[model samples]
Target: MSRMRYFTKVEFYNYRADSGGEKAGYYALIFFFYNALIIYLFGLLMYKTDFLERARLYYSNEHLFKLAIYSPIFILELAPLLFLLRSKKENLQSIGLTTSNTAISILLGIVGAIPFTYQIILDFILHKKEIQLEGANLWVEFLILFIFTALPEELMFRGYIQTRITGLIKNKYLAIVVVGLLFALMHIPFQMSMVNMTFMDYLITNWVYMIQLMVMHIYFVYLYTRNNNILVPIISHTLIDYIQLYIK
Candidate 1:
């Protein structure tokens, strides 16, 4: 395969026998809206309501709370794709789940992650920040970050959304940017809750960060389209989150 390019044409797997650009675009919009709604409602329940406090009364284990939030979202994100696959008799590879380009994909992922990795190292040296795992369960944290956060996200955004958009838009760069914007927008509610910011405040104060997120996702789009392998972006996404969570 040739080296990946920003303007390179993106190839997509045919999830449906009669998959046309218009049809794919329609389903993609539906999936995006569904995901955004789920996230918005969950964020409201977690932060705006007394749901977490009420739940904490019964479940003493703090990990359960994280699991409670992530597990359901993960399942919800994967459900539509799973249902389509089962009904269509399509295999996992239909969403770029195969290990066909495992070695190259991993290499590219690591290569793409180096700059952020260097920044973490620099922070450690300059600020003397201590690297520590957030919880006692190291493997559990890794699994949760990798399986729940990274895998489903890459599968949804890069695998499904980007693929469909690439088909709909002739300009691959435009398609990737559109997916990047959607990816960034999806995080707005959750980020607002984390920072205790109102929607307007978030847009005003964190617009730069939002654009950076979009750029970061654009790279993820490049990674996925580069090798036509979801693992490329999945590995990079997991590694970046792991380092930020554990190291920084």
Candidate 2:
């Protein structure tokens, strides 16, 4: 096997020239803001209201409550992209969904996930965190993480947002950085809702985590761009999240 090109300037330039890069960027921004708004509203509800309590009471099951929350958010995140795909008559392959490079993609996915996996294990060893793995519940959690968290998030950030931004921005590296920042910022509202922290407080305490997230996203972009396959990042992301559960 040969080394894959991380980026191809000519290819990106041609794509931008042919694909209406400006229009794509405009749509990307719209989609991003729309998703952000949805996330913010959901977070606000979760924070201010007894939405979780109500859902837990209604479902009478932890799994059901989680599903109730995550499923809708997943759908909302993908809704605009689905509509764009349909209206534009664009196929999944256009958004890096092809299996053409399955083996390499999977290899890169594992490679990208290694550092996070190592860190998680180290944390478990150093902090003496309990490894909680309820068999059936673990499977359910993995499914939720993969479907709702990894799949939708990678699709939105790496698949749609990053791809469009690459075309719109002249510098591919800068585009990746921009997307990384956007990816990190998108988590703010939800994190705030979860922790009940103000923006400044969250940033003050979690700045390191935010930086780590951005760096990780840059790696994800590299994997996606290297393979031209979204599966690469999705696999890595799913594995990372699933492993984190062990320490959580």
Candidate 3:
């Protein structure tokens, strides 16, 4: 077997350190980089090698490269979280409580889908983007797209990674910032330089998406803690994505 090394807090160094004496961060690095490599290779296989065109969080077209990019990551997400849950049971114990608070929290989550819904709506109303409705292939395409685009992301971002990291960090707000940034980082390879004219443009663009993600993560984690199950965040994420799809 091969051993792995990690970088702490997502930074590079001239000297070697043990990533805070733990390799979890390295696993995250590997997971992320592996996905990037897969996206490129799969794009080649599909002859969609024009990866430079996408400068946003998602691709405009559906290809096998994308399908491969997400599903495996989503699958691996569950394993790390489950491992964390067992080994760090004490740490995770306080996260989500199965209490009566679940009801209110869940309601709040459904309400919190407004921002993206609003943006997508405005984009359509202003004709910034063409709105597709009732096309013979629309529903089918959407369902397939939604499953790959939304489900895997919500699963990775909200379902597993965020939850485990919060346990490790033991701070909700900090964890949100960290994981939210990661959620943004995960999108960067897809767009690279086009998403940002410079690093600042990219950071700012990602920051908007990151803020929305952070808020959603906080809200879902709130519900999870109140309700005491992973399902609340999962369902909340799914609902939000559904609204994003339908609103435009």
Candidate 4:
């Protein structure tokens, strides 16, 4: 229980002009690169050990990856930030984890999910394909994606990193864009490994997809800032990702 509180109860790293200097830059670098490293190492572990391949025969590889790789590292990646916040006695509300505006946040989350929902429908219509739920247990997919994938990613990116970066950069707008780019960049390494083509070929082929993800990240940041609630983006992001399962 105490360990859970330590991870879930850390305060936001707020922006103060005097604090947004070299030290902030250092922390920002640690936030992005270090988390990226954790992800990369896990991907390598899954690839080398054939855990992904073996697990896919029984379960959705995506769920397995999140369960076996992303979730654990996500917890580890969050620890130092929590320690820093704890030491400084910062307010967790600044990180957007508050229950202050519960009703409003839910409304905003549903509204924020609309455009993605529209896009998902349009894609199915254009492709002449039905949106079908695939898997042995759909609820398991939901649970994994919601708990391990959506929740952790939101907590790591929107909840902690973005809040901290906003403090460090001193320009909330630039911080959002930079964070969006980092969010996009983090996926590239594993994506490149998944493809058989050369690095240049992979880049050329996936540039559009990369742009889309970065745009999604920007939208997520927008949602987070709009509601000052992490739940807004968490719900938005989870639905967006789950809907992708229906896309061919």
Per-residue CA lDDT of model 2 for 1-248, tens digit only, reads 11112224235322453556667677888898898889989999888898777777688677877888888888888988989867655677767778687999888888888887987877788998875875447778777888988888898988777777755787878887888888888899889888999978998999999998899888887777786789899989998988876666
Per-residue lDDT tens digits for candidate 4, residues 1-248, read 11112122222323544544335446766877877887766666665578766756775556565576556766777777677666556556645778877888878877888897887767778878765665535677767777767777787777767666755666667877888787878887666666545557877888898788789888987788775788898888877787777555
TM-scores, each model vs. reference: 0.84, 0.87, 0.52, 0.77
Which structure is stronger by lDDT: 3 or 4? 4
In model 4, how many backbone clashes occur? 0
- In model 2, where is the ten-residue run with the lowest total lDDT? 1-10
Model 4: residue 232 alpha-carbon error in angstroms: 0.2
Point out the higher-scoring one by TM-score: 1 or 4. Answer: 1
lDDT of each: 0.76, 0.78, 0.49, 0.69
Instruction: Indicate the TM-score of model 1.
Output: 0.84
Q: Which pairs clash in the backbone of model 3?
A: 96-225, 97-225, 97-228, 98-228
Q: TM-score ranking from best to worst? A: 2, 1, 4, 3
Q: What stretches of model 4 exceed 4 Å from their correct place?
A: 1-14, 19-22, 53-70, 122-131, 196-201
The reply for model 2, stretches above 4 Å from the true place, is 1-14, 122-130, 134-136
lDDT of 3: 0.49
Best by lDDT: 2
For model 4, give the 10-residue run with minimal summed lDDT.
1-10
Output the TM-score of candidate 2.
0.87
